[model samples]
Target: MVTSARPQFTAFIGQQLLASGPLAEVAIAVMNASRNPAAPPIIMFADASGQPIDLDLRGTERDVVARLPQPAPDREAATEEASTEPRGRGRPKLGVVAREVTLLPRHWEWLGSQPGGASVALRKLVEEARRANGDADRARAARDAAYRFMSVMAGNLAGFEEASRALFADDRRRFVSLIAGWPDDIRDHVVKLAFSDRAEP
Candidate 1:
């Protein structure tokens, strides 16, 4: 879903923006449109700076263009430069295909040495790796979100601890009065963790 959000404009700089001065105008455009990775690669490359600066994109355009996807590599371009180049091939994503690969005797021996694993078809390995990588990325995002919540709540621990203690008090009415309005996220976690604490006689 996220990848689908891309930019369509690639080659053209609008007349007004071109007139306004090169890097100064386009840089703003790129910052505004970063979320849309599919946008024309040229526009994105030109405005990478959050704010615009005065420069002729024409004079500097060669450097800017190098950063963008090219229709084809020039023969004079170094191989390393070619490898780093973007193909500007449009948003059509070609998936990595899985196929059998011949393994050297040492490599085969290495595969056998792995614990909790055996030689799997290369297709399975590729698919599983993609799935695992996706999951790790999602997990990292969730961890960051949870940590933000934890940071806010960590500042209010004394209040939560007091409310939690109130819930364990002998006087039911007093306990109810004490924790009547705790933050829902905190209350939910506290209640679950303490649910077993009430089981004993």
Candidate 2:
């Protein structure tokens, strides 16, 4: 569900942040760091999901960039193409899917009485539900993303388990306190991922 027109990445060498930017930049940075025998292993993470990304850093910068995964088809471009095409449809292509819905007789009667009938009423209800749960949904997603990152990067760190529990419990103070002794970069990234749903103190 994490979609971004321009995806970003963060790279770290051990506990030190190497680079944070687009894939091309991070790939080049990783390539450069790999040359140094003293540098620790480098890891690149997707900023959106806090999941590690493996890049083929086997060639020159241009070659590496060329081998990067192609971006998904832009929704805007698809919409423009659809707009230009001749329309001979009953309803504009809203990408609506028809599905069976079972409801009580009273519910059906209420839906049927709405301004745009059952479909519109159902869509409105669904939208309202989504809006109502938006904050909780975002918080859940942030917790999951933070957990994924921590499981890989901080699993062996002190208080990691307690920090994870506090993360899911939405105890910002306790979570921060638990991770206070972690390396600066790792701790900051964890905080960024865990509290991404709202501004961090």
Candidate 3:
């Protein structure tokens, strides 16, 4: 069974963390609290990624329940049509889609000269590029996510400037030290998001 990605979110009530978890749970909690005027106005943000989750909670409980995942549609019919016939010449067994790719004359010439023609060469090149840059891409994404969360939550807090500097400098220890005095929930959450994939020195 393929597990779906569960994006974590954190909800806040006037700088204080109210709830943190999957979007559906956080949204529902915020929605319920919104019913009471005396409750602090709630704002929800996605973890590390720093994007705000805008939920329209103006619905009945049953309506909200429907938003959660139900049983996936049965794919038994799709499974049966599996491997009866041989693949055609143009369409390979791997289900390769043919799309138009515009290239300059020299580029086309270079690709056509490669083994197994331009398509195979292009695919190999793309795969090689992806493999080479994969780690750096992921690290950059993590840094951006951490920055987003910090900008929204701790932008005005003390040591924020220093923390931001440490973050961009890739100085993990200094960053942790700078944010040590932050609220327990905020500090912990930020640390988890920022350094979850990083190694301890």
Q: What's the TM-score of every candidate structure? A: 0.22, 0.73, 0.71
lDDT of 1 by residue, 20-99 (tens): 22433444444444436565432222111112123223335355444544333232233234346574432123222344
> What local lDDT score does residue 62 receive in model 2, on the 0 to 100 scale?
91
Q: In model 1, which range of ten residues has the least summed lDDT?
A: 1-10
- Kindly provide the TM-score of model 2 when superposed on the true structure, using C-alpha atoms: 0.73
Between prediction 1 and prediction 3, the one with superior lDDT is 3
Instruction: Name the runs in model 3 displaced over 4 angstroms.
Output: 1-4, 65-103, 113-123, 199-201
Top-scoring candidate (TM-score): 2
TM-score of predicted structure 3: 0.71
> Could you tell me how far off, in angstroms, the CA of residue 129 lies in candidate 3 after the best superposition?
2.5
Order the candidates by TM-score, highest first: 2, 3, 1
lDDT of 3 by residue, 7-124 (tens): 6788887667888887777878888878889887677887747676576677886677567554333333322332344535654434456889999999999999998789768977
**Candidate 2 residue-wise lDDT, 1-201, digit = tens:** 333358778999998999998888888999999989998988999977889999888878898999999755655454455557665443335454576999999999999999868876897798699778878777787788889988989999999989988998899999999999999999999898878657522
Model 1, position 89: C-alpha lDDT score: 35
The alpha-carbon deviation from the true structure for residue 162 of candidate 2, after best TM-score superposition, in angstroms, is 0.8
Model 3 whole-model lDDT (C-alpha atoms)? 0.74
Scored by Cα lDDT, where does model 1 land?
0.38
